[model samples]
Target: MNNLFHSLLVFATFLGLLWKIHRAFRRASPIGDGCVCGGELCLSSP
Candidate 1:
């Protein structure tokens, strides 16, 4: 039981971290811009 609980906790934490990173990336990148690379790597939208 303890092991299962621990696994769930770790999984939840990982998911939370991933969600935060996803949000950060979204904020860094503009919407409707299918580009992940920011700055010079990304092309300017017309």
Candidate 2:
């Protein structure tokens, strides 16, 4: 029982970390804009 509880706690922590990383990446990279690899700039629609 204790082992199961420990495993669940660890898994929950891992998932929380993953979510934070995903959010950070999304915030860093805007939609419809390719990564900063010298690619053509995506013009915003008026």
Candidate 3:
């Protein structure tokens, strides 16, 4: 039971890290920037 709990904790931490990295990349991406500009052209240009 203890080992299973530990594994679950580690898996959750790993998923959190992945989520953070994904968010960071999404924030930096051109598509994200284009959305702020509010046009289909902006999205298509990038």
Candidate 4:
């Protein structure tokens, strides 16, 4: 029982980390400068 709970906890934590990383990547655009306001394009870098 204890081992199962421990395994589940580890798995949940791993999933949470993966989710955070996914969100971060989605927030930052790969092409050009990363736009913060979800605008169509960034004309210049700050």
Candidate 5:
């Protein structure tokens, strides 16, 4: 019983770590847009 509980805990931790990594990657910008900094060059961009 204890072994099963420990395994589940380890699995949960692994899943949590994977979720954080996934979120980090998903939040990154691939467009490299200068509008992120509120620049004048991108002011005209919709």
Candidate 6:
């Protein structure tokens, strides 16, 4: 019984760490000034 409880505690901690990493990646964007190879396009037209 004691060993079972210890294993469960370790598993929960690992799961929490994975959740944090997943959230961090989800919040990141893939596009930015450096990411674009083409020159900037004007958003307004005269």
Backbone clash tally for model 2? 0
Q: Candidate 5: list runs displaced more than 4 Å.
A: 29-46
Candidate 6, 5: how far from true, in Å? Answer: 0.4
In model 2, what is the error at residue 11, expressed in angstroms?
Answer: 0.1
> Candidate 2: how large is its RMSD?
8.6
Cα lDDT of model 3 overall?
A: 0.70
Candidate 1, 7: how far from true, in Å? Answer: 0.1
Residue 39, model 6, lDDT = 36
* Backbone collision tally, model 6: 0
The clash tally of candidate 4 reads 0
Per-residue error (Å), model 3, residue 43: 16
The lDDT per prediction is 0.67, 0.62, 0.70, 0.64, 0.64, 0.57
Give the TM-score (vs. native) of candidate 2.
0.64
Model 4 bad stretches (over 4 Å):
30-46
**Residue 36 lDDT (model 3):** 56
Write candidate 5's Cα lDDT for 1-46 as tens digits: 9999999999999989976774465457564335344556444544
Report the C-alpha displacement of residue 22, candidate 1, in angstroms: 0.1
Q: Give the TM-score of candidate 6.
A: 0.59
Candidate with better lDDT, 2 vs 3: 3
Instruction: Specify the poorest-scoring 10-residue window by lDDT in model 6.
Output: 37-46
Per-residue lDDT of 1-46 in model 3, one digit per residue for the tens?
9999999999999989976775576567756645555655345534
lDDT of 2 by residue, 1-46 (tens): 9999999999999989976775566567765434423244223320
lDDT of 2: 0.62
Better structure of 1 and 6 per TM-score: 1
> Model 6 misses residue 1 by how many Å?
0.7
Q: Cα miss at 18, model 2 (Å)?
A: 0.2
State which candidate has the highest lDDT.
3
Models 1 onward score TM values of: 0.65, 0.64, 0.65, 0.62, 0.61, 0.59
TM-score of predicted structure 3: 0.65
